[model samples]
Target chain A: MPPRPNQCSQLSGDDYAESGRRAPAVQIDDVVVEKGRVRILDGISFTIPAGSITGLLGPSGSGKTTLMRTIVGVQAVRSGTVNVLGRTAGSAALRSSVGYVTQAPSVYGDLTVRENANYFATVLGRGRAEAERAIADVNLTHEADRLVGRMSGGQRSRASLACALLAKPELLVLDEPTVGQDPVLRRELWSQFRALADAGTTVLVSSHVMDEAARCDRLLLVRDGALLAEGTPAALCAAARTNDFEDVFLRLIDAADQKAAA
Target chain B: MLLVVPSSLLTLVYSMFHNQPGRFDHIGLTLLAVFPFLTMFLITSVSMLRERTSGTLERLFTLPIGKLDLIVGYATAFSGAAILQAGIAGLVAYQLLGLDTAGSPALVVIIALSTAILGVACGLLCSAFARTEFQAVQFLPVVVLPQLLLCGLFVPIDGMATWLGHVADVLPLTHAVSALDAVGSSSDPTAAMWQDLGIVLAFAVGALAAGAATLRRRAA
Candidate 1:
């Protein structure tokens, strides 16, 4: 079935500044999320600028994935709202424009690399030509017909990214997109990310690797579901009086822990 | 896939050959005689199993797709495949086996579809109760085996205890088998077949509703 037009609306870069709203590509207002009895997110609010890269950095169990899920509209918000491309997250209209690649490879193991892309495109209403292009974007054009199960972890990750880019989304959300990648492939993937951003796509990437954070135009430091800080990597390092993004992150995490204890 | 088709056909042909002689030869039963239980335990349960195995269920819940749409899409995909298998088997039976069946081919197709739908529903519901695929597969005999004894496949309905018969009467497959037999064997459409259709529809609709609720609640 053709993906509903509303689902793809977020993919289009148009209407971003219509009626003087500034019209963020992604916006979360007073958001709260709970899993069972544990509060996962608390009153989080932020906006991702169109055509830029935003990095979310946190340690494990810091609620980074939960926050990402909330933005995609998969988890129900306990309170507050999440909007993607100006429409509510999970809204039928926003799903099409939002491409999400989870931390794990989400491709079908039984299907070939290209078949996985084909299935996602079919659901996303992307044409065959677009799918082929997405295949080329990830440098998987030659391995397109190979079974996903046979592909290496890095190749599978690339295949997953290819699937995410199949519809040419306006907002791309990737959780640890470069986790298993080698150095050369990692550089190539980062370049692909830059190209997407240059083309007016808002990319939100989550990573524990501090150097990756340096690559983003903006950074949101999250620890235990609260925002530690948000700013450009250089500004954040300067504010923390640290030489590197990793040192800045450690300093902020330590400070938050000390403050909580006191 | 082919197993589901040929197995169903074999049951019918065996029944005709046995010809034990009764108003109902009580021979070749529809796939529902076996499918609802197996499907409830196999295909229907696979969506959840896949999600859990891949850790995608939780990830998927984080996406924008609704719980209803997710289940519906999965079921639709499996049902489409099941229908294809049924069609091929039916075609082979018509041309090769030369079985003199009655009623519209569409009706037979509906019979197969309803069986698949019920199978998917049962599989999904059973999956909700299982923590692993092994546990899910274990549900097969417990849930499906009863149909053989209770659906009058091996023993005549008359031979069953009154209480057992009463319980069987309510099962969707009990009616499905009756309806398919009516059409496949050239018997007149009986009130029993209509009753079975209603019951099967109820099973499909009820499973979908309850299954979605269960999946969503756990997904969070």
Candidate 2:
């Protein structure tokens, strides 16, 4: 059987703290990513602390997805480096240790929800029972036998999430996972992300929604391929002298524009 | 089902017009040579493109699975379907259409299977270059059509221009058709037939390797 959350203290506390002190779950240093002639992520640097939820907050096309892809080792970087779990990003050794969910639902359409999850679990060297647990965690046990293609948009995304959850990866990178989801489902999913983080999994969730930023342990507010600020939501709001994250974000962007002008 | 109906109908019509004792054998050999290649190529390319467009391939790339595992898995799965299709086509040609050949029937079946496997390999290679299903189908005309025209399916390779004959020699389908023709004419598989089969298999392996090399985690 897979180790329960409580039993996985090695992932949570002492070792995690030691590791956190030495190295983060993910580290991006002077990273630059370009698509064609356009620079997508320009000289970005950040470290995600282990055993916490880090929200990557940005407007659409602000390079949030590109940054997440770089972290997962799928995106090509023109220069600089991304290190994940103490290895170079996209290294074969980190494959099992990292789980990623793209913005779009990425589950196999021909396979049932359970089958898709099981296949990924098997690929990650986990067994079928873990797949069942993942499906249940995503609250898709009722639709386990249903084909992913036939599922509703929300359910299909959940199925994709379930697939990523199967390996119980140490680092989970979700790109707009709660997009198009209802409020209750979104709340449940946030709780699930928190629960995973509480169990020692480092969750890096990207979103364009500012309200969700409050739920994160730290927020990396980005705009136009640059990070405007990185801090806890409350800290960021206090620094900007505003409680509204949206206002804070705007103020930061304005500050960046003025700095560039100067 | 979709491929067999039209091909079998065409064979029936051609045989009725020819009206010779051994004409069905020629038609059968041609269909066996071409149908499996065309069907498997179209099916594999489209299915792989579907996987890419649907995001499954991207998701799979993030896992611990290697590129070889994916390419081989696709090849193995489609090869099973290819075998089944070849079997059904062979049964229809030999039993239903009364194809008469001096060569071993088993050799013909093996040749059909080889063509199907070649199709799978070539399709996979082509899929790596395609972004959409339409683009994948476009390869049928740009890639497969040229091979079909020059594969010695219509004019004999010996009768073609010297340069065209050299082109045919390099085309994998040319060797496939040559092997089928050899098996159809001779009582035993010849050294030439074995050589042609070897080249066809080598082409399949090479194409598969190329496909693996070019496989991307995401569509560009």
- For every candidate, what share of the true interface contacts is present? 0.23, 0.55
Model 2: per-residue lDDT, tens digit, A55-79? 9987789999898888887787899
- What TM-score goes with each of the models? 0.83, 0.92
lDDT of candidates 1 onward, in order:
0.74, 0.83
Model 2, range B1-220, lDDT digits (tens) per residue? 8446635664665567475666556656766877778888998999988877787787788888989899889888888887777777777777776677779888887887888889998898898789899899999998788888887766778999999999889998989888988988899889999999999999999998887777775422
State the fnat of model 2: 0.55
RMSD of 1: 7.9
B122 in model 2: Cα distance from truth in Å?
1.3
**Interface RMSDs of all predictions?**
3.8, 2.0
RMSD of each: 7.9, 5.7
Best by lDDT: 2
Q: All models, DockQ values?
A: 0.26, 0.52
Sliding window of 10 residues with minimal summed lDDT for model 2 chain B = B2-11
Candidate 2 ranges beyond 4 A from true positions = A1-22, B2-18, B217-220
The residue-level lDDT of candidate 2 at B92 comes to 73
